[model samples]
Target: MIGSLDIAIICIYLLAVLAFGWMFYRKQTDASSFTRGNGRLPVWALSLSVFATFVSSISFLALPGNAFAKDWSSFVFSLSIPITAFLAVRFFVPLYRKINSDSAYAFLEERFGRWARIYASVCYLLTQLARMGAILYLLALPVNSLTGLGLEQIIVITGLLVLLYSTLGGIEAVVYTDAIQGILLISGAFLCLYFILSKIDGGFGGMWQEALQNHKLSLGSFAFDWKSSSFWLILFYGFFINLQNFGADQSYIQRYMSAKSVKDAQKTVWLGGLLYVPVSLLFFLIGTALWVYYFQNPLPEAIPADQVFPHFISTELPVGIKGLLIAAILSAGMSTLSTSVNSSATVLLTDIFKIETANSLRFLRTASAIMAACSIVAALLFLGVDSALDVWWALASIFSGGILGLFLLGLLVKKSAAKLAVSIGLVFVLWTSLSQMFPESPWAFTLHPNFVIIIGTTLIFAVGWLLRKKD
Candidate 1:
């Protein structure tokens, strides 16, 4: 039983989603309209869409947990993204534009061959399935705890609201919904920060300094420590991680692709980079504030540290304000979840199913239904994992590196055969998967599995290319 205010807030969110879907539905008469919002969006809209896509329900919970446990070192993984943002515009945009295809993987076929295109699409679909599953698990967290609802019940009810609106309206509806969710997402984070700060004796700055004194500000080791999850292995390969996430991940690239021009797309990427940095700082600040609040007013022993934010919201704020925060959490979850389902659908139609044969509305609806179903099932399964961020990083290791390799090879390694590119790139993905699962012995340098994936893929591709030339 949610508070009336929280229920109201959630209702507003869903209603807005439906109305926006209707507005965009009329404009989306054919497949292109369905896939890329008819390609008329401004850069600002695209940037906001990108931001909403990346900042999901997982972050709402995990960022605080990371701050509660780790410190500024919590952001070490963030070091890889700014670099990738720049690369996405310079390398990815031009190639994607030149190819003039609706799907990112379509470029591989135009440049390499049909097999290469199919290969890229399959990789994207598989990776996205895993990612979407994780997001569903994330959103379901609130549904479970907030209303005492079962996971399957929440999955069936709330998840349908997100999936159906997206399937009917396509990218157009998704972009509009995402833009509103973005503002709410940022506002919600800030609201949490204010509430946590207001309840504490001192403000955020004082608490932050207090946290530093307690060594809660640790950023972990900068030097590579394969055995330590907090060490520099992730940072070492952070640059390439940025590349693949922003450049090759269709979940992101599709936002840019929706822009009417390359310049518009580039601006969207830069704006997202600029704004996201500060918003993340606010999340970190909220975590530190909660750290202090807990010390002053101790929590129950059985409560997990990760639940600090929720506990505070439920207890500290007045019922109405608490309701707002609850809606905020749902906003964060729905924002990313909707984007994932929609992107997965787009990739299935244009990239995976290769529906390039027909540019009709019928093809678009058929693709959306098929792909959305797959995403819904995948998301339902991944929810069992307890740590939201852990799932994100593991998914990153499995696919991010390999996707980066294919895009880079397509963009820069001009003469590389498509079949060779797909074969070598997937081999790298397989190697990373194996390395993550096992090591030579107990003493083996246990690098950040993400580091292992990116480096493994790059090395494998270069060596494979050189070997083939020699032969």
Candidate 2:
């Protein structure tokens, strides 16, 4: 195991994050400050924050493993990012800003009523917990193997440290920490790419041939699933997941809200989307390189492919480079956690507490504290999940069906069909998801995950529109 240096670097990274949280704590005693940094942040700052919120540990570690095991077919999904950003910026961001609301779900209450608002808020809260928990669990895998810490202790300690600063400092703290984490993550990814290629003997072409010989370098990763992870199938599947972020997730929304204006929010999101393609490809490339590395030089024993990146980092890299890799892991874990903890509190206060409508600093503080506690508990429970990516997809898929309905209905549907549209839309998503979940699924529907959000959302809106017109 790569011992003390890795532990030292990670501990330093946490302290830096803590210092940032404290620096931003300019007495965030009210709801607005806690949720959104008083809406004074620059567009660039919020954009970077959005980027940080997404560059998660799962992406840091798992994306490469996935691509290595599979192929560039993952890029098919990566393409959905720019399109999703366009939807978020041009449509959803403006809609929420026009409502001038802190919580994205508040748009539900404005268009629908209190029940709808509560429903969306509750869903966002539950989903954020799931995401945060998955973040820690993924982090635990890397930290435990490298540092000899037990998974349970690592989970608790990681959860507590994140909850402490996030609860104390609020959105400003979250954004700053995320901004730093994002930069570190992006740089670290490319650095890892550079090092992996350097060691591969032949630069790019040589590595390519090695992967090709071993059935690793195929670009047609979708260019179809054998039941799971097919090439062309991933294209549509990736789009559905991206749409949920561009359309629904509160963490995504809250980052947009932090922007100086709607235009800034829109521009930032699209830019981030454009940025994702190249950055994401690096993950796949690293995966392929590792595959070649193993093919050319076999791992010591039955090392998990998921540990492929770590195996390279621990064994091949010099000591100082190993420290930097540990820091990259911090970049993955803390950035996402900071953004999530802030977003969760935003949902709790803005949507759940309805605090903006009232004046209660004490109430806001109390709510912040309660939200932090909930986040810790949520992370603990999330540690129990067996698979990170499946849970991540399921979460985004479920919430998206309804949120897509709300956004579409809000913008296009007339008053007569509004309530029915929402009702039918909810049922459509539920039924599709339920059918997809059953063991003996009928192939007649071809219940591929690619269509989960796309088909589920479209049918709900399109069918509801037809029925409403007839009525």
The candidate maximizing lDDT is 2
RMSD (CA, Å), candidate 2 to true, equals 3.1
For model 1, the superposed segments whose C-alpha errors exceed 4 Å read 356-360, 417-428, 431-447, 468-471
Cα-based TM-score, every candidate: 0.91, 0.89
Q: Over the stretch 1-471, how does candidate 1's per-residue lDDT look in tens digits?
A: 468787777677678777777777677677777778767877777788788776777667777777875676756666666777787777777667666777777776765677766666676777766766666666666556666778777766766777677777888788777787888878888887887887777677778778878887777776655556654665655566656667777777777778898888888887875566677667777877888888777777755545566667766777566667766777777777777777766776776555554555666666556665665687677655556666667776675536566666666665655456556666656655666677685634455555655665576457545544311
lDDT of 2 by residue, 356-436 (tens): 445644455455556655656655665545456556666666665455655565567654355666667677666666766
lDDT of 2 at 408: 65
Backbone clash total for model 2 is 6
